[model samples]
Target: MISSLRKDADIIIKKSIDAVLPDEAVKRALKGFKKGTGKVVLVAAGKAAWQMANAAVKEMPDISEGIVVTKYDHVKGNIPGITCCEAGHPVPDENSFSATRKALDLVRPLGEDDTVLFLLSGGGSALFESPLIPGEELQDITKQLLACGADIVEINTIRKRLSGVKGGRFAEVAAPAKVYSIVLSDILGDPLDMIASGPAVPDTSTCQQAQEIAARYNLKLSDEARNLLGKETPKELSNVTSVITGSVRELCTAASNAAKDLGYEPIILTDMLSCEAKDAGSFLASIAISNSRKGDKKLAFIAGGETVVHLKGTGKGGRNQELALSAAIGLNGLSNAAVFSVGSDGTDGPTDAAGGYADGETVSDLKEKGLNINLYLDNNDAYNALKAVDGLIITGPTGTNVNDVSVLLIS
Candidate 1:
């Protein structure tokens, strides 16, 4: 039944998401933390800042003081001990600068015997910020990084150079105090230095790498920004320890198990899935098509990672939406096939939609309404196109960010 398959798909995806909630991951990581006798301060930054901070406070209610900075509207309520501040995301705003200053100040007063629990997660690179240059220039550079096809590692290489507190500089600010950073990684391989631009970890990247990235992308930076990027960030930190508590691997494993329970043979194609979003979608569709040729029934193929989208068009859509749209085009003539892509954070770019879903009939449905799928893809308008076909998957704020997940179901 079509309805049954759709329900099964939803179940699999939900399992993936539930396995990576920031609260659960933080709570697990807290078991390893030894309570400090001196002042304990918490600094949480990312899209999941509120959830992570709430979990930390729940685990250790004795936090002396704290600050939580997240994207606007991500902070749902007040934590009794922590000051919650909403800031800009995907691009740093003036609020981002102010909140980051407050966070830095919170660390500056720490004693040698004190402890700073830094809860880091995805989107922190934008939500947590202290630019060496003006806010306007930082925003411009961030926009360039997002619009270009450069990966997280590359973007962060440039960012750490321009930040006052990134690339282990935050740890330096909290010097003589122990900084415990529990991180939920949204980047592939769970690279600590790439996640949130490695605020609490040492910079393994060099000024040459930053310069190369800007040059490769043809990114125009201000004179001050250029100078900063050529300089080095902190390369060592003795007081910081980082632990990756969650990542895409966990999300993929959960999806695999859920699909198996639903009587679908699940294959975790890759956890390191990256590349352009559209190309990745097409490749997944190809795999589905190959399996379908074998007359296999009830197969679930999944891939997880963040993909980049080089913006050639000003159209509104996130990488996940673009992925699903591209998959829909590739699976146009395939019967009993469905493809979906979702951001674990429950948002795709600037759109409210988490991502998208398309069945075998999606192309036909669009055709019947005189919609051109190729045109939408070329314009990078997947959000609008998928909305027209009722293909947008809108899940508001999952309170976590592991990465993106792509699923293909065949019967």
Candidate 2:
């Protein structure tokens, strides 16, 4: 059963990522740009930024010059022509700010004869932060929104107003240069304006919307942020073209296909799944148990979306880790079943571990170590709890980000 579960999980992970590989997305989006008609300047930002940029270079060798900003550890092998830089994520740092400025400079000189291929995916918000608000203020608001358990969309809505280069402003900055955005969406429903705060898309959200979100979350913003939100979106940027080539639905389809290939009947639980991480974990486990009780010979259930973690403790872990741990607690001693949850990017939250995987025996294994699940969870230490029970899944970095993928199998 362990071997079977491992195999199934591996297949699911690989297939899910393959569905959103940035290179394929880029190739598809670039069809609109006539070859040799203009200089192609590629700009990408996210955890998958490097891989996406590398793929673009491979697909369009004539790309004159490119700039890519990715998370520190996400930088892949060197690409000769593209300038690659590492930045911070989930929170902006000096490097991220520097990269954003450089990217702006690189794109600002573009003429109507040039084209900008913008590759955007998850984590771009933090990897490139050019705050219209003061840097310190933006950082403070970001920390507050995260702590308040705001969803990705809500947080990004607020982020767009606080930034100088987000919410289609990047496209605006390179005005008259035809913009083509290829996106790997991490948000539910794949809203073009939410992914990476829509660097090259239209701004559907106004400053009022951002202000309301901040107020609703009781997020304190600097005076500069407040002032910026009052300003109007520039008019010249409305012509930018955006396309979403990857999303949670694509990942769910991949997982379903993998399950079918493994001889299991696949059921997609939901593509828009969202809630507190722990609750999602418990709900999925209950559904898994119910399906197992139905006497199905082979069953697989898949779900995708970003789940939020309300941090009360200083423990190390991510939303995926918490979900896996919570599922383990709910599963207890249920037989012939296994559950796994992983961030598609292969790093969950601040932890080095990708996520967690567990079987029926997970509870027993934890008990043997005298670990208290509730305490660990309260302390936000899901990583250690799962690690102690040999349930942690460590994939380092997967170079793709669609969101989180959860799978349950009964055999």
Full-model lDDT for every candidate = 0.88, 0.83
Winning model by TM-score: 1
Q: How high a TM-score does candidate 2 get? A: 0.95
lDDT of 1 by residue, 1-411 (tens): 455656777887788888888887898898888756798999999988899999899889889899999987788898988999998878989999899999999999888889999999999999889888888988988998999888989999999988988888889998888999999999999889989999999889999989999999999987888899889888778998788998999988888888888888888889998899999889878876787667646899989888989888878999999999999877877777788899998889988988988777778889998999999889899998899988888878888989988999887
What's the TM-score of every candidate structure? Answer: 0.97, 0.95
Model 2 per-residue lDDT tens digits across residues 69-97: 99988987898698999988788888889
After the best TM-score superposition of candidate 2, give how far the Cα of residue 2 lies from its true spot, in angstroms.
4.4
